[model samples]
Target: MTPNILMTRIDNRLVHGQVGVTWANTLAANLVIVANDDVATDDVQQQLMKMVLPDTIGIRFFTIERTSQIIDKAAPHQKIFIVVKTPQDVLRLLENGVQLEQVNIGNMHYKEGKKQVAPTVSVDDADIEVFKKIKEFNVDLFVQGIPGEKKQDIFNLI
Candidate 1:
C-alpha cells in the first residue's frame, strides 16, 4: 500500500520514541522510510528502531541512493515519511533528482565542530554549505521540532 503523506525530515537521532509514536500517526504515514547509509548498514540499530515504531506504522530501511530512486516513483500516492540524519544525505537525494523542495529539520543534536543552528539543529560548515547549495535547487528548509512548531529557516537564522 502507498503511504498517506510524503515528508522529508532531518532527525539525527533517527527513529526515537517521540517521533515514532508522536509524529508518525499525525502524518498518517503508512510507510516510514529511514534514509541513512549508516543506519541501513547497522542491523543492530535498525532492529532497535523497528522495535520502537508503533505496530500500525510500516517502516523501511534505505540508503539515500535507494531512497532517491524510489521516492518519486512512490510519492503522493504514498503516505510516506523520509528521515535523513544529515543535510549531505538529503543533498545526495536531491542531486539524484528527488523533488523534495523543503526539509523539516528536526532533532540533529550537537556535536564537535557542529555549530548550533537552532535549539534542535546542529550543523558543521560542510552541512551548512550543502544546505546553501541545495536551496538554489529551490528546496525550502525549516527548523521545527514537532509537527506544529513554528518553522525557522536555517539560512535566514544563521
Candidate 2:
C-alpha cells in the first residue's frame, strides 16, 4: 500500500507559499507530507500551514519515525510530495528504509556558520557530511528551486 512518491524536497521552511502551492501543482501531488518533529507536535503551526493550502490538496504532519511508517504503508494511488527540513532528516529516513527515487534541494538559507553552495542553498560542515552520505546511497540528488529552473547536482557544487 505504499504511495508513489513523486518528489522529495529539502527546504528548511517546510511548507511555504511557493513550495506548498506551486510545487504541489507542478508535481501534480495530491498529498503533501511534512516530516518534522517540531511542526508535527505544534498545533498552532500545523493549523497555520493547513490554512494556506487549497482544500483539494491533502496535507499531513508527522515525526520522522511516524513518517517512515506512513511512507512504507502509503496507498499506491496517492502521489506524495515530501518536504523535510534538512539533509540529515533525509538521511535518517533513508537509513530507516524509506525508498526515494530522487531528492530535490529546495532552500536552506544561509546562516552564520553555513557556506553558500548556490544562490538558495547554504550548508555547514555537518550538512556537507550528510550530503556526502546521501551521495553514497547513489540517490539522484540535485537542486532546483522550481519546476522550470535548471537543476544543479549537489555533487558538482560541493
Candidate 3:
C-alpha cells in the first residue's frame, strides 16, 4: 500500500516519547511504520515501542525491506509515518523503490564517530553517503521536526 503521508523522520531513539506522542499526533498519522532491522527482529523491543504509541495508531515494524514492499504496492491512505533509524535505511527503501519524493528528518542524535548537524541531527560518513544515494532518486531531504520551522538540508551542509 502506498503510504498516505510519508514522513521520513530520523529519530535514533525511534518511537519514543517525542515521536510516539508529539510528532505522530502533529502529523495526524494513522499508520506508523518503523523501518529498522535491529528493532524489528527483537520482539521485546517491538512490543515495547508498540505500547508507547497511542492505541489509536496502527503500528507496524519493518526491517527496511518490508517497508519497500508495502509502500510499493500503492494503497489509499491518509497519513503514514515511516520512521527509519538511519539515512542508510532511507537509501535502502529508495533503492527498493519506495517512491518518496521528500524525506523529513526528525532526529539522529550523537553517537560514536558521528557528527552533529544541529542540536537535533547527527550523522557519520556512512549516513552522508546513503543520503547522497537518496539524492540520486531526487528526494528533498531536510532536517526539521514540525512544519513552519526553518529546515536545514544536511546534504547541503555536507
Candidate 4:
C-alpha cells in the first residue's frame, strides 16, 4: 500500500531544528525518513540524529534506492516526512517510484559552484536542471523554511 506522504523536503542539514521540531510537529508526521546515501551508512550521524529527535517520532536513515523500495510499504496510519540533501535525490526517489505530490526546498547552503537563489537556498546549473526534471513529474516545489512562513516558488528563486 502507498504510504501517506505528508511532506518531502530538501534540506542539506537533514533532521535539523526546523524539520525535527517545527515541520514534524506541524505535519504531525510519525515517521521521518532521512534519505541520503552518505548518512545511511554513517553510524555517528545516525546516532546523533536519534539523539536529537524525540522518542515518540520514528526516524530512518536510508539510501534513495532503499527508501523508494520501502516507502510505499509504510502502514496506512504512518504519516511519512521525507528529507533529502539535494534536488537530485528527490528526482531519484521519483524515478525509483516513490510517489510524491510536493517538495519543499528548505535549505541548500551556498557553496563554491552554486549561486545564491534565496536567502537559504543556492543552486548550480545541474541542480536547476534536476529541479526542472522533477517538475515534469507534476510535483509542486516551493521554499519555506518553517511551517507558518510564506512559501516561495522555488522556480522563481532558481
Model number with the top TM-score = 4
lDDT of 2 by residue, 85-129 (tens): 999999998888898779999999998998899989998889889
Ranking by lDDT: 4, 2, 1, 3
Q: After superposition, which runs of candidate 4 have C-alpha atoms over 4 Å from their true positions?
A: none
Give the alpha carbon lDDT tens digit for every residue of 50-109 in model 3: 888898988888788877777755358657888888788888888787877778887877
- Kindly give the stretch of ten consecutive residues in candidate 1 with the minimal lDDT sum: 1-10
For model 3, the stretches where C-alpha displacement exceeds 4 angstroms are 146-148
TM agreement with the true structure for every prediction: 0.89, 0.96, 0.87, 0.97
Return the TM-score for candidate 3, rounded to 2 decimals: 0.87
lDDT of 1 at 96: 86
User: Model 2 scores what on Cα lDDT?
Assistant: 0.90
* RMSD to native, candidate 4: 0.9
Worst 10 residues of 3 by lDDT: 69-78
Q: Put down candidate 4 lDDT per residue, 1-158, tens digits, no spaces.
A: 77899989999999877788889989999899999999999999999888777788899999999998888779998989999999999999999988999999999999899999888999999999999999999999999988888999888887
